[model samples]
Target: MPRIVSAFLCAAFIALGVTACAEPAHQKHAPQDPPDYKGVPTDMTPPSMLTPSAKPQ
Candidate 1:
């Protein structure tokens, strides 16, 4: 039983090592400036497009 447990642990560790080594290297994305929002519109919908919801009696 002890040997079986040890074998399973060793297999699991080897599997983990193999998977770790198979992954792609970490990539560094180029730094980018955030988009300017100084002139953007804040209101998505105007008051003219609003409608009252019908209520059940």
Candidate 2:
């Protein structure tokens, strides 16, 4: 009985710790309008998804 109770307590503590560490939900910024493309290149990959080109300095 004591072992079961301790195990339950430990499991609960871990769950609480995970919940506390999570990022809080909040209202995100409204989407921005697309920028003018006249001067910009047609290809626009997100910075995070971009890979380094083979060309070196």
Candidate 3:
């Protein structure tokens, strides 16, 4: 009876281990797009674009 019980417990542990190791492989993460700067320019033109003739003194 003891041997039967030990065998059952061992089988249960083995089944659990097998299931734990059978998880699906991790998926590759997709690269996220950079934030939009659609209406904005990167560089600022000197003397202001608003006042074209205002030269630096």
Candidate 4:
């Protein structure tokens, strides 16, 4: 029947339109580098040592 054919055509058009309007799900994120604290001193003094009065009252 013509009505059935038209219904199928309309469904197909709607599917194609939805596919065309939809964006690709794939995304590219920028590569991140590992933290590099190579030159920082490992044996730094505590903040309390820098200011003696910073102790608990």
Candidate 5:
């Protein structure tokens, strides 16, 4: 009976050790979009057209 109990304990200890030493499962994360930023004007216009040209000196 003691031999059987010791053998069972040894087997349990080995199983627990193997599981504890194993690597954890990989976790995946969803890609996140950056914050919506409004910087430049939406309309594409040339600076020269927006402002009148200075008279040549």
Candidate 6:
């Protein structure tokens, strides 16, 4: 009967779904070591003070 076929198909789909959800989840691996941070130094001198005419004669 059509009802029997429908019930079998539904059961098959439910089993497939359960099997798919039962698999272990993937995990990300951690890095071996952290990278070193080098700090950047800023220039404190004024732009106008670096010009040739701005220097002492």
Q: lDDT for every model?
A: 0.85, 0.85, 0.81, 0.84, 0.85, 0.79
Decide which is better by TM-score, 2 or 4: 4
Cα error, candidate 5, residue 38 (Å): 26
Task: Please provide, for model 3 over 1-57, each residue's C-alpha lDDT reduced to its tens digit, 9 standing for 90 to 100.
Answer: 999999999999999999899966775786665687456665687655666665799
lDDT of 5 by residue, 3-42 (tens): 9999999999999999999987875876665678547468
Q: On residues 3-43, what C-alpha lDDT tens digit does candidate 6 reach at each position?
A: 99999999999999998989667657854544664554578
Best by TM-score: 4
Encode model 1's per-residue lDDT on 3-45: one tens digit a residue. Answer: 9999999999999999988966775797665687467677789
lDDT (C-alpha) at residue 52 in model 1: 65
Whole-model lDDT, model 5:
0.85
How displaced is residue 24 in candidate 6, in Å? 4.6
TM-score of 5: 0.45
Model 2: residues with Cα > 4 Å off, grouped in runs: 28-57
lDDT at position 56, candidate 3? 90
* Local distance difference test, candidate 2: 0.85
Q: What are the runs in model 6 whose C-alpha is more than 4 Å off?
A: 24-57
Clashes of each: 0, 0, 0, 0, 0, 0
Name model 1 segments beyond 4 Å from true: 24-57
Write the number of the candidate with greater TM-score, choosing between 1 and 4. Answer: 4
Predicted structure 3: lDDT: 0.81
lDDT winner, 2 or 3: 2
lDDT of candidate 4 over 1-57, digit per residue (tens): 999999999999999999999997887886665588456667789886775565686
* Stretches of candidate 3 exceeding 4 Å from the true structure: 25-57
